[model samples]
Target: MFGPRHPLMLIAVLLIAAAPAPHRPRRIVSLNLCADHFLIPLADRGQIAALTRFARDPEISAEAARAAHYPVSRGTAEELLALRPDLVITSPWRRAAIAELLRGRGVAIADVPDAQDYAGIRANIATVAALVGHPDRGTALIARMDAQLDALGPARGHGRTAAYWQRRGFLTGAGTLVDDLLRRAGLANLATRLGRPALSRLSLEELVANPPDFLFAEAGPVRDQGTELLTHPAVLRAVPPRRRLHIPGALIACATPAYPRAVANIAAQLLAADRIPTRARSQ
Candidate 1:
């Protein structure tokens, strides 16, 4: 039989083992723009360790002004570790190495899924809410969103039956989020008839030759570039001037809570372009 250790020594070892881990984190860091939006509102100002630098750019984040006061980093693992965050919230699309490094250092990592539709967006809001111990807030947010969506009313049927969306020659086809938004706004996407996926590239010549009743063009920053694409000299010469509307590219990119606003804007723009004088055009 082995000799017994001293009672004092054994007691000291047990006490040390029972002590809570010192490396556990109490601060949270956000690594993406969407996560920033979800987490910032849920977390206390003191609890937020850092946010990505891009979080301050209004072009990418609508809550930039509110986020400007927080500590910001370039989304590198080294920078994240320097902040000593207990938890890191990031998009699923973040680099694997950053996640691995944080995990290796015993930091909790929450990889939020990309919300591609209305349901997915609601689920994502709940997920973020749970992380910040504010599930009730998530429910409230969802309720508000539901109310907004419900107020949209049934899809109207007065608009042109077929429409083409030209975004730098890429068309939004059936089954895509943009297509869903268009359908919700009471416009038919012509891309589906062409038997294409979410997006398909079509030449300006082809578009002019077989133009749909309505054209929604996504104009970029430069008016000249958009003018060249929409009013291409060849296209201007060939196709008769019909109804053309410009939709800012940002509105159609992300499936966020602001999507309903985007849908409303697009619907209003379409109604204006269609010259539909009915009061129903006041979306």
Candidate 2:
């Protein structure tokens, strides 16, 4: 122990003990749509330097409104490098050129995975949160998602068949993210029963002939019947109006924390359809 008379020794020991740890990233930049969604809920607004332009479009991003407060980028190397973010988040699958360019210039970058199931979603949320110095926030968000799912009870997957029919006769197939969500919500995907591929074409005739318990039509009205197959006259006539529930592009477009909300939305729609009187539904 240093004696009171030895002031120099005591001062040196105190300075060494109180030395601060290195600082973490203060500014983060996202170069992909999924990465933007991950950053929005996990990082503080101040931590975010810029999000991709998709973050501003509600049609593709579930966090459009939340992202409005932050500056957005188009993933240009020059613009991204200008921000000098402490950490850069992106998807190697997307914006590959930009990701490569930034990395070549010695910028810190992390790739966000493309999640196809609940497990993937949780892993992604946790990954992003930890990188942003908010692992607990990720845990809390996941817990909330779990609580929401638990509240839904285990009675879902009543074996009721559903279809995520999109534009141009495109149907969401089995072993896909939407399919997984459908099963979680207690509904079976029609694509599996139909034995369709990932991008199968379901003609209006087949859709009408084998109508599922529910018909999930894509968002928007029939701007052009030739292109917008969901609005085909046969589909409109065969699928009962009450049986249809249009899902916005934003909900199923990404596998983010908002995913639980999508599940709940579908469940709510199913419940609403069930509530309709059989006679009126058939009319």
Candidate 3:
């Protein structure tokens, strides 16, 4: 029993003021797709308030299966406020307006940066983990990713070039996650060699005139005009089916824990291509 103004009471008050603030956000909401990727694996399931609707779509999200279990928000202010999120994780690249709106209302925001390479990936993971009050979990996830990459061994591209040819002839260029992934597999990005920007479209004729050793096509059914172009006769002739590696759209959709999976898949595909005859391989 100490009096209110006692020296011991005063010291206790000062100590309490100096203590670190708790960072455990119990009601976290994710507005960015990339944020959704990291949130699903790092944050406790109970800590999550909601994820974006895209989080449940397997075609875009690597953690779609797990994210499916969480509630989803369309990112509308009303919807987000109703969830009473202690932390809102989002990207400044997209949904800046929504994030700004939320901020004006006094919501705490964690702006997740765009990860263009593996180092960025590690940083993003760490940032999200710490935000969720689980820095150890972030470190562990990064360690696991590093270990898996080491076990996977060296790059297997063998100086070959490839183009991440997307629907409608769009080529993924330098400084992008796709380009970094290509380098990891020992392959060079044709877009960089051509002096193309981060995202640009190459016509069918240009593709035929300067075809790379391989075409990194998106894996999925042809569902529309965009996807239809991927399977056009011109594309098949420029880079034969045998020389094409159809990676899952979800894998490259974002830089997340699934990055290792994408790397492994690329390396495996390149290894398989090695066993083929030089003439057929070039075809």
Candidate 4:
């Protein structure tokens, strides 16, 4: 029972007025391809202001088709400022300088690291979902992902060794998202077996000299000299086409909503490749 002019009531009014206003970002910008993965799936389409230039590239982004509807940012501080984004998602690994500049300007930003495994993917999804003010969406996404993984059942590889061979003689190794994917499929990575680093090159001769039980390469035509090496005569002789598993480049580029697709594709392709004639699969 206090009067309106009571000092205690006056203090309460002042406190309420001084409290920061609650806000949910309506204009979001993604500064890296990795951020684009989360922003596209979790945020409302209208909430998106701009995405990275690579967002619509099917060669690397699984959400390329959906991303086409959104505008893209050049990633420069000026361009980002012009968009007047309320929340900017960035990968400090890719554009640290730009993030720093934006921070100095008092812009709200969130740093999303590149996910390296299933756990990392879950963490990133949760981070983006909460940032977009949809924590429930994040939970739903993770639940869907868990269900998809559970449907994959146990690993079927039977400890067979497989190499994720790429253009330019590059080999994906352990301590990476691909390595975790390989493990989930019950296949041992050739790079892990050979004690190779996360990323290393092997000459055609070296690859043939100690080839894995299966070679996994990107599907599509030979578009350049680098890709041409994947179809060289020696490579074909070392590992026949039947033993060469092909996966789309988009599926394995990152651990986003597309990750479950990548897992299913690999599992399906490996099962099919396993049915090849023994003679044809032999080195």
lDDT tens digits by residue: candidate 1, 215-261: 67644543655445766666544433445565554454455566677
Candidate 1 off by > 4 Å? 1-26, 156-167, 220-227, 234-242, 274-283
- The per-model lDDT (C-alpha) reads 0.68, 0.82, 0.88, 0.85
The top-ranked prediction according to lDDT is: 3
RMSD to true structure for each model, in Å: 10.8, 5.9, 6.2, 6.5
Off by over 4 Å in 3: 1-22, 93-106, 220-228, 278-283
Task: Give a tens-digit lDDT track for model 3, residues 1-283.
Answer: 5666689888999999998864888899888988998988799999999999999999988888988789998988789879988788887865567566777666678788888999999999999999999888899999999999999898999878899998888999999999999999999999999999999998888888898989988767898898888888888888888899977889888888899999999999888988898888655
Q: What does candidate 2's lDDT look like per residue over 23-117, in tens digits?
A: 35688888878888888888888889999999999998999998898999887777987898878887776546655666656666788878889
Rank order by lDDT, top first? 3, 4, 2, 1
Q: Where does candidate 2 have its weakest 10-residue lDDT segment?
A: 93-102
Which pairs of residues collide in candidate 2? 156-186, 157-186
Error of 3 at 17 (Å): 16
Error of 1 at 210 (Å): 3.4
Clashing pairs in 1: 25-86
The TM-score measured for candidate 2 stands at: 0.86
Q: Relative to the unseen true structure, what is the Cα RMSD of model 3?
A: 6.2
Clashing pairs in 4: none
Pairs of residues clashing in candidate 3: none
